[model samples]
Target: MINPLGIVITVLYYKIAEKIKKISIFSKIPPIVIAGVMLIATLEIFDIDYDIYNESAKYLTIILIPATIALGYPIYKNIELLKKNKRIIYTGFIIAAVIAILTTYVVAKMCNTEFIVIESMLPKSVTAPMAVEISKGIGAIPELTACIVALTGIFGGVFGHKILKLIKVKSDVAIGLSIGAASHVIGTARCIEEKRESQVVMASVALVIVGIITAIIIPLFIYLIK
Candidate 1:
């Protein structure tokens, strides 16, 4: 049977983490990251089995499905913007997918990292699920891919807007696509926090489309290089 105790503990930890995020130094850090770190420490300190804790905590991932669908509201509200910029937006998605994959590959190769590690890192820009499947096909470690994806999301969510501002990027859609393409749902969630409807809409769209584009491109990229 599922353990409500795990759910209760996880939720409790998450709420506290959210409050902690209000601190100046921590304001840029994600609540999930804070909560996750604390939870891991608690588990280690107590010698608790992670699988037991995950019994109820796994259900929370189920909530993500509906949460993702709800993001469509912003997209619907901003339909005209998408319609007007369909051509540019479509082209941007392809570019976003290609650049993310290529940069990771090129940099990893340049650093002379192990090929398996590089493969695992390749799908880091996409969301977790897509990254896992892509990892399987490409000889990447799913566990490492998941970690990379999370870290990628955190980096983009924390630094993306600031970098955009520094570069004088003023367009909401451009910022949204850039974040979403690089960080997936986590970056999109950041847009929602800022309450920018245009960014939210474009980011919501960008994460999904960019994942699709990345999935399609990876195979072809592997084949061409081989």
Candidate 2:
């Protein structure tokens, strides 16, 4: 027979994590669920700090990359749709790139946020790992950038359709580009679910283009302003 204490601990921890993950409040927000589990576990356990877990978490995250790569299979399978609308898709990507960078820079500046904060915020629409690296390259806080990126993705995924509808966006290509431009990876996931071929392409383009743009623009702005 197994030890009851071990089983009880395992069940309790899993139950807590599952409850948080399944709840409507947390279901749509992956970053929050991930963070919540770590927070709760740390608080309930002995002598475990975020720093300690963070050092170890890098190893855990390596396994997650392959899972993310699996998401690309659907996009590859839908290449016919992507090819048919190449013109509209490319135009949408270009426009989306311009809007994402400019709006983020303008809003952060208008809010009187710090230059580094603004720099970090500019890449908040990119995938978290990429955003963190971009923030570091531009002399911003990686942790802050990661948090903002996660929040931006969650907001974009949850409300992208509403915003698109409100703005009367009619083209599927345009809609796809908008989601990719504003939401990054999470938005890409939503696009995949909708079978939006244009979006998948634009999202891939947006991730690369916007990342490159932010890496250039934010640093240049800091130098010019100072």
Candidate 3:
């Protein structure tokens, strides 16, 4: 039987984390990161195996599919904007994907990373499911790929706005595309917080586009290089 206790504990932690995020000092920190840290510490203190926690928490992961589909509402509401800028959106997505892949490969090579590590890191910019699949196809570790994907999302969620400001990225479309392409759902969440409908729409669109492109291109590229 599935442990109902685990689900209860997980939901409680998330609720507490959300409240904590509303505090002035913790406002900037993403709730997922906070909850993750809290969960890790709690597990360590109790000497709980991560695999056991994962098994207990599997239902939450399943909810993510429907949650992702729900993001379409914002995009659908802003359909006209997306249609108006389809060309630019597609162009920017392609460019961002290319740069992301090349930079990951180049940095891994420069650091003298192992072949498997390079392959795993190559899909770090996309969503976790796609990243894991791409990593598996390229003979990389799916677990490692998932880790990199999560880190990318967290880092982008936390610091993406500051980076964009530093680079003087003024366009909403550009901001949305860059964050979504680089950080996936976490970045899209950040974009939604901006309280701008257009940005949310563009971010959602960019995320879907980038995920699709990464899923299609990375495997082919790996095959060619091998």
Candidate 4:
């Protein structure tokens, strides 16, 4: 029998790509729509008759790294601006990252969730792939971490622009910080769409800063909870 996930992903990936190419709205890249289609395709098409499919997915996931790396060129183009606004970019990212981990930890503890679960939730503010790696390093559930990451991304992508506008966050630097701090890669996409080159650079800085902060803090929080 043909692998179902392969068939489904093969079909829908192209469809989604086509839709994205043709559309020009926020709905074009809704994470829910993308992820929902992916999940549904996985279940319906992938036979799951054995554990091999799970193993194959690992190799597939590795391909995403190159895409992440491609983001670096854009950052390189704006490196001069980054050098100038170093303080603002670093300061905002550190504050946002710390708050994200601390808030998740405190809330998880208050709700009596296990330490590992909290550790998993700690990286929810980052991109999903990065969140999964961070979760694994800290002994958290990667799958659960992925779900949280997706939810965070969707929420950020869907409402972040409106929220910034409502709050009168007019500065491109500030807007970029908010998107990177809150939504990770999805937010970066939003920043670039506004034609703000500096904001895009700041968004990259925000993700890096937040990723580093989460890496150091999440593990310590897990230890403390243990």
C-alpha TM-score for every candidate = 0.78, 0.69, 0.82, 0.80
Better of 1 and 4 by TM-score: 4
RMSD of each: 3.2, 5.8, 2.8, 3.5
After superposing candidate 1, which stretches have Cα over 4 Å from the reference?
62-79, 129-139, 189-195, 219-226
Enumerate clash totals for all models, in the order shown: 0, 0, 0, 4
Per-residue alpha-carbon lDDT of model 4 for 105-155, expressed as tens digits? 788889999766777788988876667778778777887888788778777
RMSD of 1: 3.2
Please give, for residues 1-226, the per-residue lDDT of candidate 2 as tens digits: 3234433433456566667767777667664447545655654677655555555455544554575456456557655655776776556555665577778888878889887778778778777766776677778888788788878887888888788889898677677667877788777766776786666666655555455555566567667767
Global lDDT of each candidate: 0.85, 0.67, 0.82, 0.73
Locate the minimum summed-lDDT window of 10 residues in model 4. 48-57
Comparing 2 with 4 on TM-score, the higher-scoring candidate is: 4
Most TM-score-accurate candidate: 3
Residue lDDT tens for model 1, 98-188: 9999999899999999878987898889987777777877776876887889899999998889999999998899999999999997898
Comparing 3 and 4 on TM-score, the stronger one: 3
lDDT of 4: 0.73
- Model 4 residue 24 CA deviation (Å) reads 6.0
